[model samples]
Target: MISPTTIDQVFETARVEEVIGDFVQLKKAGSNFKGLSPFSDERSPSFMVSPVKQIWKDFSSGKGGNVVAFLMEHEHFTYPEAIKYLAKKYNIEVEETEQTNEQKEQQDERESLYLVSEFANSYFQKILHKTDQGKAIGLSYFKERGFTEDTIKKFDLGYSLDEWQAFTDEALKQGYKLEFLEKTGLTIVKEDKRFDRFKGRVMFPIKSMSGRVLGFGGRILINDKKAAKYVNSPESDIYHKSKVLYGIYHAKQSIAKEDNCYLVEGYTDVIQFHQTGIKNVVSSSGTALTPEQIRLINRLTKNITVLFDGDAAGMRASLRGIDLILEQGMNVKVCTFPEGEDPDSFAKQNTLEELSVYLIENAKDFIQFKASVLYEESKNDPIKKAETIRDIVNSISKIPDRIKKEIYIQECSKIMDISEEVLFSTLAQINKKDFKEADKQYKTEQRAFEVIKQQPVKKVDVQYVLERKIIEVLLLYGNRTEGFEDLILKENDKGQLILEPVINRAKVFEKIFLDLQDDEMEFTNPKFKTLYYTIIDTLNQNPEFQLKNFINSVDTDMANEITTILMEDERYALDDWERMHIFPKEKTQNVAQLVTETILSLRCFLIDQKVKEVQQKTIENKNNVNKSVLEEVKDYSGLKMLLSRKLNRAL
Candidate 1:
């Protein structure tokens, strides 16, 4: 547990952008910072962070939260751990209280994983420096690759001994837990057997932004054709390869300072570039460029100069990467090394100044470079030439900025000797077809929960729909304090009792809770019932409700459920609402009315359901129709009519 004062101090000190920027790459999008989602693999940035509100929302994953929540979700930190992390980040002293057993367990598990990883890193480093095999094989191999001792130590490079159980046995003898070692992928355990996962390999420690060792990437030294050349840490609580960049930990500052990032394809490319005093560089670790990796660079810089190996396959890979970058609306320039040279080898051969000049001279805009290379290959065949033109046009269409797209189109027309109008037509068709496909996918996805519209009345499951509506209302408006009109009996001028409207102040949750209790109504669905009470309890406890904080605090499933309900009504909401001269009324404008109407509709539904039940009972006892059953049907019918009238609906 953490003291409230420390929590408040942490919140006040930690900037949301500064904290989240350490993880996901964020670029300014209007008033908010938008980037690729760390929670999911996405090309376009669906993850948004609002500096003003100090909150973040990942539309792709339906996760939203305050800064603390972001840490909790992204780092898998416990609430107290997240608070402490921020406190440490901001240099705030923490005042603690005793934590529950659950917190202790969670904290212990995650901390151990990190501890074991760091220990493994140190142990491997010791072997590299102290042992005979480490020196003769690993040290010599690095020297041959042109890496100096200082460079080797700076990057925390290490060597794993050839024997399988040597590393595992040493780890356990040091009092480290085998569970954590296996969890961090330093060791593999199966059916009471344990062995080092990276035996006889050179180890590369993968680190988080703040420089904590998360996992490792190891390269095999021996000439065993059966084994993979490189093996990465498997996905675990601490490490996700897709969400990490190879040299981000080292290059973040330089990338931000230079306002440009040099992207390469291998670890050596990144290390060699840094050794040459060119620090704004990272690698995809032999994996194809991912949106997550691109956004990691996007956080520090918008401009990416992709350094491609001078080979046929590298050119093809470059083409694929360019399209993904364009889709992210980034300024991308492609630079290929001379024939038979790669970024690693090229950097080793040239001085920093020489390499920098070469990059500047050789760099070309994606459109021009793509057109020139793609055209040369297809110029002989007219049919292939036509396909190449479309391919270039397709990449241009990926640019999110209309101006950029148009400029690229004009450039393409000149290079291809085609008219701008024809190019524009091709771009429009590609965009329209893409739009239709997206729309169709969206419509298909919407079928699971579309408000029960277009269904027969008898098949509608009206009770379930009404129950969902109640939960939605509570989640959206529960904390809103408003003046609600209540009818009270009053003596008029004639001294006769009469119904008069009275204004009373109450929270929306209070009104709904009281009304539901008054009628002994409850949600039928087990999930909805639990969720309803959770929302009501949460709202009741906090008079000033913070939706993002609440969403971040709850479990993932609950947060997702709440977000789904909140986002559903806005499913049809057009972003061009003002441009289209259309505006929908805000639910906030009438919180009291919305609550009243939702409750009234629920009562009416329940009453109608009761009436049908009674009528069914009467039919079952047709020979001697129960008098009480007839009155029951009549009473339910009259209640339904009255409720419908109150709702301004025909009975």
Candidate 2:
């Protein structure tokens, strides 16, 4: 129900790069910016952002759109949410039409879940700051862990009351359904009894990349023998713990600014580091690191440093994560704390500078860290040592950049006391094995898809010719006041002013556009009805609509289509062509240019003929020498002169 004026503001203010840059780290690549694909696992960057066009396109994923579309695709935001987010970011006032109950009922389940989760986040946060149970339990726990009031508020940390159904009572009173509460695992329903799921536990709300709260992780206060220490929201439409990392919402900016992400294993680890002035840190929250999570981090920064407790098991568990990070085309380094120390304890015990210095001095490359950790475990046994070396090399092979792979291989050989050639040989074998398997998988999927390659639309013949002529006229002279003669047509021996079958180029476009609204049509095909509509819309909007603007608005998928329609039937080098008759020099260029212009101009005239003929034929068939049809031809004749002027600009 957003107003058209507000929607226009959102579109105007939401710069595509500014919005998408929040989730993807963009680096300048020629005229465009390129980044790793957020939707896929790719080493080379295939995601492109065009600031001039106000759109982003991911070649790897085949998704492309303007700023709102990017938000819809990347963060999975609803159209209204995306518009509201842009408005907030750009500080624009939003005016919305009132929604009825039926309109509210039309919201999808996924949207409903997002709304419920967002409401819960606000509810929990209010309790933490306002209620006695929250202040006494959650605030105390965070304070005891060395978090300041500012840090606590920044993260929106909160708690659920000890009494069962406390949150449920408030939610239900607010008209939130118990079913959604149970579905989101906010209120556990057992034996037909519903109660607040996180009763008495401090809250940790997990947020999506765009900062909407998707779920929660809560910790209990008492050391109850029967109760689990921590509980997280169950998997739902909006929340997937395995695919999300804690503190990402807060740390994404810092990570991008610093160009490195500090990866930890607990919520406390994130708080302690941020409290100590290191803001580019996030936690796995004790879940095993996943490629999806790593790719999420990869989208923000290419460098990741894993921080682990000094325990042997913790360090070993971190090794697997390191390999996955490498597989994601990221430069990874590992930093383990002093024995018995973790990020939380270590940061609390030391100054920010001291902690940072320790991390920097102790950080080791993935291969060195792996070799050092496993070398002792293997205990100089030849087979065990060889297996360890191969394992490290296999991880190295995962790196997509050849130069980086070579450097790591060289470093690994030096650290493991093995020959460089041996590691290189091992890496090649592993890479070949992986490549073959991937190729086979891709071919299998492609074969399945090949079963139904969609058929192409039939080429537009006369209608296309006519439409392009009108579009060209509208593009160049829609608002211009040019003198016109009122041509008359004789109908039943009576003479009257003529109007074309579809006169007023803008009106003609709108009528034809409304007539063709198929969703399955590919806009790339020049014959596509959708393509004609798209072009017509652009032509009708701007009084000064030019060919360049039309070309700029389209994505690569439609770029050729627009370009072909504009240039193939429109002259660009008429002046140069004229030069050929007068000049001794520039024969090749002038002749070629003349040939091109002749072809283009003839095409335009032919299209105009088709438009006139179609209008004339329709009038003749009706046996009414239509007066409107004569006026249409007169208006079109005036447009033809303007179009010729546009084409002969150089003259």
Candidate 3:
């Protein structure tokens, strides 16, 4: 358990810009820093880091938080992990108290899997370096493949001993549980006996983007005909292969720095590329590419250059991945090495400069790559050529950006010697078919939700607007002192009613709270009601409450809402209105008026609702014409008139 003092120290010392800059590239934008959102694919900057507020907001994804929250959200770190990461970053020594037995026992299941995976990774690395068999076999294989000792260590390459029970026995002896070992696929338990899963294989530790070991991939070096050449960890609580990319932990920063990624098909391809000084590279780890994998890269950069071996299988894999990349709206380029060499062997055969030069010269846009590869296969067969042209058009249709699709379509038409009009017609037909299929599926699903159609959604317009405005005011200027004016009804000496004005000064939150209390008003929106009370409670406890401090204490949804409200203008600050000599007024400048108007508007809206309800009741029971019902309707109508008069609105 980390002490409160350490957490507070971490929060105090960590600067939002400095912390986020480690993951994102931030350029100065007025009082804040702006960059492309790390949470979404965007060509323009929408992520903002405010040093003053000590918070960051990615407008693209509607995610925002303080430094600790950002780490937790972006890196998927647990609370303790986020704190520890910050502490390590800022060189702040963490102060901890020992967890009780109960606390230790209550640790989450996913975290236990992470612990076991980490232990397995370390254990395998130790064996690779410390044991005779590991050094002779695993180290020899890697070294023989032209992998440097530094590269081997950097990627945490290792070797599992050939003996069936070697890893299982060692893990059990070290107090690591067998259940987690089996869950992480490091140990295989069978019929009251246990054995290591990756026995006699060279280990490749797979890490999450934050550098935590998620699982492992192992390769068998022996030439046994029956045994599979490669094995990967099974899907587990902590590792989902489809959601993770190999070398992403090491490649993320470089990917962002270079504004492009070199995607390959295997672990060695990624490692070799990194060793050759092209750090922005990741592999699908030999799995067929998935939309989830493309989105992972999409978060860092919009550009991907896929490297393929100059073989039929490699070209097929490249073709399979390109459509998925385009579906995610990423710009993809393709580069194939010379015949008889993969990324691993090719990088080894050439110097770093030669390898870099070859990649630059060989890279082709996806449209061109598709046309050229498919054209060669089609030869002069007109029918086969037509099919190839349709295939290329289908890939172009997957792209969501209209301008990018148009440009690619033009290029494809020229390369395939097809008319531009014909390609456009084919694309429209494909899109129309897709839409019809989607609509049919949607209608089928809608039938299952027939109950929802029975009760139509009612619009709570006035209450929603008024409640949200109140919350925005409290979040923005709740602590500031402001002067407020109130209108009161008074009797003159002649017993005539006259309006009187009274003025007072108080904190904005206090003024608003008192006004609501005087009117006996409350927010009708449940979320708004909850936020209102929370803000009031927080301000009562700490008069100096800040937005960042409040945000840090709330749950993610509430924090995002607060950030969205606060950053609404900053999102459009790129317009630079001040430079045009058209300075916008700050909300705080008229805080008291805004607060008073919001409360009065809510009150008037409520009275209007009451008037309508009473009138409906009167109509429903008009045959009886009860005096009490008439009086109720009259009273509500009069109240609405009085409130409307106070608001200076026409009745």
Candidate 4:
């Protein structure tokens, strides 16, 4: 029940680029920004943002919208959640009006989970700073790890007490429902008893791309051998651990700025790097990196620098993630720390400048990293070495970029002491196998869909004709002097009267639409009724309704439709090209220019026809009309006279 005024404030202050750039890395493309499409798999960027219009369009997926619309599309955020997120970002105060119980019940489940998670975040943070147990345990743990007060607070780090019901009791005291607490994995319920799940653990809160708290990761301080060293909140409506990357919310801006992200293994590693001023860092929290997580980082930066411990097992686990990153078309570099150290310890041992230098000097491309590591594992047996080279080439072939693949192939051949042609042949074989399997899967899905009687998808970008007609009318009549047109009807003697055109744009549209009613003129695609009404209503509201604003405001389907039409009929580029060629025509420059004059004359003829209408109307309304109408008539007459002079000169 947020007030309309509060909602409007959130919407008005929420910049589309700021919101989208959190999840997608955008670089300047002409007047707009472009990034890889979040909705599909691709190597090249197809997402576009226009700051002038405050809208974004994903050309690959055909989705476009304002900030709110993007949240809805990408995160499946409800309208209220999207607004509240923007409010939190921009620091706008939300004023909610009271809602009835039934009305409150109608709120979406995911939104409630978000609210519960947010409440849990505040609860954990409060425990860390305010409660004795939290202060002694979580705060002490982070401090012992060499985290400064500002660093801890900046990341919203917190602690949960060792008491069984400490967090659950406080959450319940604050009127948070046990059901939702359990749903968000903040509380564990067993056989009619409930308790805090993160007791005795130092808290590391996980955040959404927009920086909203979604869940937490916690580490144990006790020496219980039976207990896991670290535990994280289970998957919930708001948090999907496999799909989440810790510190991404905090590091997105820096990652985008640097055009790279530094991947680490744990929460402390991320914090230590940030403390050292290497800000573009995130962690998978020691789990196997999923494609979903890789895609999330891919949205922020194409290049990833994986900093893993130099242990053998660590290198093997990381190699698996490397292939996943390559499959997503991301550029990956590996930076292994010393055998005895992790990122947290290593970063703590060095200053920011030293760490930066170490990273720069040690980083290796994926192929080299893979070949070097696997070659060591293979112990230089020529047969095993050859197999290792093929394995490395397989990873290289997964990369979608042709240039990158070629470069890696050359590097791999040199490293393995093999022929480049042989490696290329191996890569080609792997690529063919991958594509055949992919095509087979696609055909299987198509067959299944056919059995379900699903209709085949019609071709995309095929309905330019209808869109062109709409644009044609808008350009011709947007600001014209418009009035209602009268049509003839049968009289008593079966006589008829003439029809007249309308001066009002809305009325002209209405007349045109009515005339086309029996013709059943189709727009060639289905649209939501509300969106259709919105477009029509906007055109009806403004006498000078520019097609650009309306077109930009709608979804991608309509915007693409309008842009295609506007660009299709206008040969402005060629027109200028021909105009510039005037003197090059040998001794026939006059004839070349005369043809251009003919088109200009026809344009004037159309304008003069409208000018005569206004002039006739001016005479009829001489005594009753406003003075502005007379001025408009004079302007039109002068324009017509100028055109007439041009016509005479050309003749």
The most accurate candidate by TM-score is: 3
The root-mean-square deviation over C-alpha atoms between each candidate and the true structure, in angstroms, is: 7.0, 10.4, 4.6, 11.9
Overall local distance difference test of candidate 4: 0.75
TM-score of every prediction relative to native = 0.68, 0.74, 0.84, 0.74
Mark the 10 consecutive residues where model 4 has the least summed lDDT. Answer: 567-576
Clashes of each: 0, 9, 0, 5
Q: Which candidate is the best by lDDT?
A: 3
| lDDT tens digits, residue span 1-651, model 4 | 688888778766878888898889887654467788889977677677766556677766767666777888887777677787789989999998665645544667776677677777777788899988888878888888999999999999888888899888877776667888899888999999988888888888898777777888888899999988898889887788888899988899999889999999899999999998999999998788999899888888889999989798778867888989988888899999888998999999999999999999999988778877888878658888878888898888888889989998888878888899998888888888988999999999999978877766667442343344444454334334344322223344446442332233334345444434543543444542343345556767876675545653566566555444433322222233344564223212233233324333444544566678877887897877788877876887666665555456532
Taking the tens digit of each residue's C-alpha lDDT, what string does model 3 give over 1-651?
898889888887889888777667677777888887877767678888888777778888888877877888877778998999889878999998766646644668777788788888999999999999999999999999889999999999999999999999988877677888888989988989889999899999999877889999999999989988999999998889998899998998899889899998889999988999989999999888898788778766789999999897669756978998888878999998888989999988888899889989999999888888888889789898989989999999899899988998899878887799999999999999999998999999899778688788887687887888888899888999887877788999999987788888899899889878887887777878889999999999997798877887888778777777677668766566667888778665777878878887888888877778878877888887778877887887887777677778898
Per-residue lDDT tens digits for candidate 2, residues 384-486, read 9999999889888878789999998999888888899988889889988998999999999988877755656577565455555444443333344332222
Compared with the true structure, model 3 gives a TM-score of: 0.84
lDDT of 1 at 337: 90
User: In what order do the candidates fall by TM-score, top score first?
Assistant: 3, 4, 2, 1
Against the true structure, candidate 1 reaches a TM-score of: 0.68
Better of 1 and 2 by TM-score: 2
Q: Deviation in angstroms for 115 in model 3?
A: 1.2
Where does the lowest 10-residue lDDT sum fall in candidate 1? 570-579
